[model samples]
Target: MVKTNAMRMLDKAKIEYTTREYEVDEQNLSGSHAADMMGADHGCVFKTLVLKGEKMGYLVCCIPVDGELDLKKVAKAAGDKKVEMIPMKDLQKITGYIRGGCSPIGMKKQFPTFIEESARSYSEIVVSGGLRGQQIALQPQSLIGFVKGRFASLMQD
Candidate 1:
């Protein structure tokens, strides 16, 4: 298996993680599709999103494939009065990752990250491996610590 930047970062941090590779369907790079390919539950698969807050420059959010991020809650958790997703065209330049392949780990810069509190219920969760068709699985708490992130109510009720 080809190692991705995310995997290499984990290795360097001595962070235990497992990788799963699946065939790429560029037309359907949704998180749910990835979970289906890995034969895992949708809730255990997370997507990383980058947003810019009015008060903060940049922040990250990791939510379940099946969950939706409530922007108001995200803003509250981020201590910003408001927040909005960065334009897709600016994704790579800002985070060094493109949509469908962005990982909460190994971002170009360590933006303040927040993981859905629901993830704490699971032992391990899957995230993009910093590349399309590759995924990384690791403990939820481990991810939070590695990313120096906090657990918050980031999803809609």
Candidate 2:
């Protein structure tokens, strides 16, 4: 099995997860879109977002496939006065992954991760497996264990 950073961390943390790979569709830019194309439940699909904290540079945000991220809420969740989405050039430079492939786990640095509080509503959630065309389905708690992410209403309404 080819392991991405997320998978490697899953192993190191002894978290149980199932890997799922879907075809890469150039037309999709959201998790719900990807899930529908892959025939997976949209509720269980999660999207990874990379944000910049004004001058702080980089942070990771995880929210449900159906949810939209609220930059204001994320700033509050990060306890920062302001937050902004990282530019594509910077995202690729820092994370070593293309726009659609960023994962909160195993970035160039271990960033503080924030997840949508609603994610706990699901038993298992799927996140990018650290690369395009792959995802991992694991218990939300196990994910929290590995990333130690804080839960908050950081998604957009």
Candidate 3:
């Protein structure tokens, strides 16, 4: 398997992880679909979201594949009053990643990140491998710490 920026960083950090490969379907680019392709448990598969805050600039959140990001909650966690999703067209230019392939591990810049607290319940979780059709599975804490992210209540109520 070819190593992506995300996997390379994990190696440099000496963080142990395992990768899973799946076929990408452009029509169904959602993380839940990714998990289904990998035959992975949805609970352990996370999706990364990037949002812009009034004062905090850009921040990220990792929630379950089937979960929703609570904009208000994430903004509060990032010490911002409010937040909104970054437009799709700007994703690659801003983060050096396109949709369906962005990883929380390595971006154009390190933005404040948050993983839904529910991730803590699992010993390991799966996240994008920096490319569509690839996934990286590692301990939740390792992934969070590598990204300098916090675990918070980011899922929508």
**Steric collisions counted per model:** 0, 1, 0
Clashing pairs in model 3? none
CA lDDT, every model vs. true structure: 0.93, 0.82, 0.93
Candidate 3 least-lDDT 10 residues: 68-77
lDDT for 98 (candidate 1): 88
> Model 1, residue 153: what's the lDDT?
97
Candidate 3: Cα lDDT at 15? 99
Candidate 3 local distance difference test against the native: 0.93
For model 2, what is the error of residue 3's alpha carbon versus the real structure, in angstroms, after optimal superposition? 2.5
Output the lDDT of residue 137, model 2. Answer: 89
In the order shown, what is each candidate's alpha-carbon RMSD? Answer: 0.7, 1.6, 0.7
Residues 1-157 of candidate 3 have per-residue lDDT tens digits of 8799999999999999999999999999999999999999999999988899999999888999999888888888988998999999999998999899999988999999899999999999999999999999999999988998899998878
Where's the lowest-lDDT run of ten residues in candidate 1? 20-29
- What TM-score does structure 2 among the candidates reach? 0.91
TM-score of every model versus the real structure: 0.98, 0.91, 0.98
| Cα shift from native, residue 91, model 2 (Å) | 1.0
Cα lDDT tens digits, model 1, 37-68, are: 88998988999999999999899999999888
Worst 10 residues of 2 by lDDT: 54-63
